[model samples]
Target: MNLEWLKGIYVPILTPMKEDESVDFEKLRKQVNFIIDGGVHGILAHGSNSEFYMFEDDDYEEIFKVILEEVAGRVPVIMGIGAIRTSKCVKLAKLAERLGADAVAILQPMFLKPTDEELYYHFKTIADSVKELPTLLYNNPRIGYTLSSDLVERLARDVRNIVGIKDSSGDINQLLEFIRKTRDLKFKAFGGKDTLLYSSLNIGAVGGVCTTANIFPELVTSIYNTYVDGDLKESLELQFELNPVRMSMDKASFPVATKDMANINGMDVGKPIKPNHASPSGVVESMRKEMAKAGLLKG
Candidate 1:
């Protein structure tokens, strides 16, 4: 498969929910248009930032359909499968293929730290199950174990459809090693952390699946656009401006800041799903001030 279309800023968009904690498809469609209009290059439905764990299989189908429909072929869509069971992951991967997604990103099985052999098989099984949809390995250490470069290389070499990885290890070196190790293969590397977008691209990542793009798509996409356009200084500067705000997410709870930023920006993405409430008012205000400092917020 020509994976050339895989390069650029991809948004792991927020799943806009209703006050009752159910997915509001209307808001989801609006969010899709919101990010695409903001200049993102691709869309990743069911990403970590999307609260994917809360939904059922039926939920996945509708979510995928809605996103693909809203996207309308404007940008490539990659459906993400982060389920823990190999069977479940395969089911979602097949679902993505059935829905006409351009690609599928499978997150390492969460909550269970499988051995290297088991891990390899887990990814291989899912990729093999799909006929031809490009599979991108998603390694988020927050799941408790990282996908070592060696493991990733082995999968890339052995699995015909495993074409890339989204390294959210937060360690730039880890991201670099994946790129370095896979350089000879058809594999593509994307930084999963928003703060490392410029550095990741500088070190040979094709692009990033940035959570911030859901809030500030133009800002995030500009980093990739400038870097690809040969403006290293501007791209680095843009990354610098994005880092503090992205880092400030730590002040709020996990994954809440992205939604907080969206709400404050007047996107009204609604509250995060239950058990994950809105960020404190002070936290949101502080985040707002940070965006203002970065010139992202005006009056």
Candidate 2:
């Protein structure tokens, strides 16, 4: 387990595309720098929020290359190597390693709902295939798959490269279970929800890999830092301040709300993928007003 690079808030960035659906390299670069400059500890390109499943192999390769080049070591680039097929995941993992990604975050195989043993084999197979790079298990149950805390412990014990787990289950009990069960191991656990950030840390989480960080990087990072620094009151206050923005996500498709918020704040991260419509203008305006009220946006 590579515990050294798994701490603090890691922003799962949204993929910016032009109106014609081409990859917007310029905006992509700007967005990367935006989050890094805003104080995020790491950038995760092509994760769920980044439309990882929508991209082809070539598209992923190109995006990974651009992200690695733009990030340029300012922060670790954690590339999403999640795929429906283990073989393909391994290929992407190897490509990420070659392209200079600091780590690879993989989601469990969706649709099939593999058994605990099968899930273990799936991750172990990929981890074995990519021995040189660290693997962060992404347990996002909302997306159709869930990795149990017991399975996480088993993986941590068995797979040498299985370094961390991101619990997006939104269940504090599950998050705490992972923390408690894996305490003796070298594995790292992170809260996957923006709302659960404070509690997750209170239970011994290393940090967070949150979609909300796409818009409120400083506030999110502050929550993690303040909590780690022992200022629980300030951290909780900041967490509460960002709740509306995080809750706004439940009102629309993911990256859509997140990307719109980014553009409203002046980052212009292009548009969401097809079928995932950008939020309505009214929703955008309301979010803008909320952001201003929260002091996240300048007048």
| Top candidate by TM-score | 1
lDDT of 2 by residue, 1-299 (tens): 44686799999988889998889999888888878988999988877888888888888899989989998899988888778888888888888888888888888887786889888888999888888788889898866867888899999888888888888999999888888888998889989888889888988999999887887788899999999899999999998998877776676666688888888887778888887888998888888877887888854
Which TM-score value belongs to model 2?
0.96
lDDT of 1: 0.90
Tens digits of lDDT, candidate 1, 170-255 = 89999889988989998999999888888888899999999999988899999999999999999999999999888877799978
Q: Candidate 1: worst 10 consecutive residues by lDDT? A: 290-299
lDDT (0 to 1) per candidate: 0.90, 0.85
The TM-score between candidate 1 and the true structure equals 0.98
Task: At residue 138, give the lDDT of candidate 2.
Answer: 88
Identify the leading candidate in terms of lDDT.
Answer: 1
User: How much lDDT does candidate 2 score?
Assistant: 0.85
Q: What is the lDDT of residue 137 in candidate 2?
A: 91
**Candidate 2 minimal-lDDT segment of 10 residues:** 246-255
TM per candidate comes to 0.98, 0.96
Model 2: how far residue 199 lies from native, Å: 1.1
